[model samples]
Target: MSEDPSLHQSHPDIIKRLKRADGHLKSVIEMIEAGRPCLDIAQQLHAVEKAIGQAKKTLIQDHLDHCLEDVVGPLPSDRRRTIDEFKEITKYL
Candidate 1:
């Protein structure tokens, strides 16, 4: 199998954003433990979900630009598989 060129090419900004989101998630957990207001906890959870969606969008864009382009041409099976995987991912969104 050929090495994937985009495997380790994630942008640092994405990593930073993910780290911040992780911190937010931890804070949410702490809020729950501390018996914070239910509405406030729900708001934090919603924010985390939005952050995760944004991160997914960024990753999907990178995949389209790099990994998908690499496997799309001259390989019908690979192309179809990639399309199927993307469709599956969209179901979760």
Candidate 2:
């Protein structure tokens, strides 16, 4: 694996997003405990999912742009490989 990029840049934003999702998940649990309607629980769950998904996307893209650049440098083949790997991984999201 390549060295991580300056965590200074992406870490805080990723943490913030994850934290928001964490809070939302907690609320989702509460909603379930309170016997909230299915639609409302589903909506909150979706929001949490989106928040976590966005965080993951941001982290992956940042790593591709920064950490992978350091490892691969200007080599075209290496860059293409990294990009392809990134593209392949993003399919699950």
Candidate 3:
């Protein structure tokens, strides 16, 4: 991490997305306890899964674009280091 204290520009949106997904997940649990139809449960689960996936992807892409750039962009001479950094970041995806 960054020594900077502020959240990244996209972080608020991601947090909102995750919170929405969390609500969806809680509803999913309720639906299951109530013995909802499988198709409906599956659809809600899919939505929750997709929301989380999108949030994760956005965070990683934002990190790669801004954070990694801040860390590596200054060292134009270090090709190998930049490549390694990119590789390291993508490992999570």
Report how far residue 41 has shifted in candidate 2, in Å. 0.1
For each candidate in the order shown, give its overall lDDT on alpha carbons. Answer: 0.77, 0.84, 0.85
Preferred candidate (TM-score higher): 2 or 3: 2
Residues 1-93, candidate 1: write the lDDT tens digits. 236565545556678778888999999999999999999999999988888778877777677666665766555785678776874686465
TM-scores across all candidates?
0.66, 0.76, 0.75
Q: Put the candidates in lDDT order, highest first.
A: 3, 2, 1
User: Where does candidate 3 stray beyond 4 Å?
Assistant: 1-6, 74-93
Q: Which ten residues in a row have the lowest lDDT in candidate 3?
A: 71-80
Best by TM-score: 2
Clashes of each: 0, 0, 0
lDDT of the structure predicted as candidate 2: 0.84
- Please give, for residues 1-93, the per-residue lDDT of candidate 3 as tens digits: 455745688888999999999999999999999999999999999999999999999888877777767766665556857666775777577
Compose the digit string of candidate 2's lDDT tens values, residues 1-93. Answer: 235536737878899999999999999999999999999999999999999989988888777667766776676785688677875686566
Weakest lDDT window of 10 consecutive positions for candidate 1: 1-10
How high a TM-score does candidate 1 get? Answer: 0.66
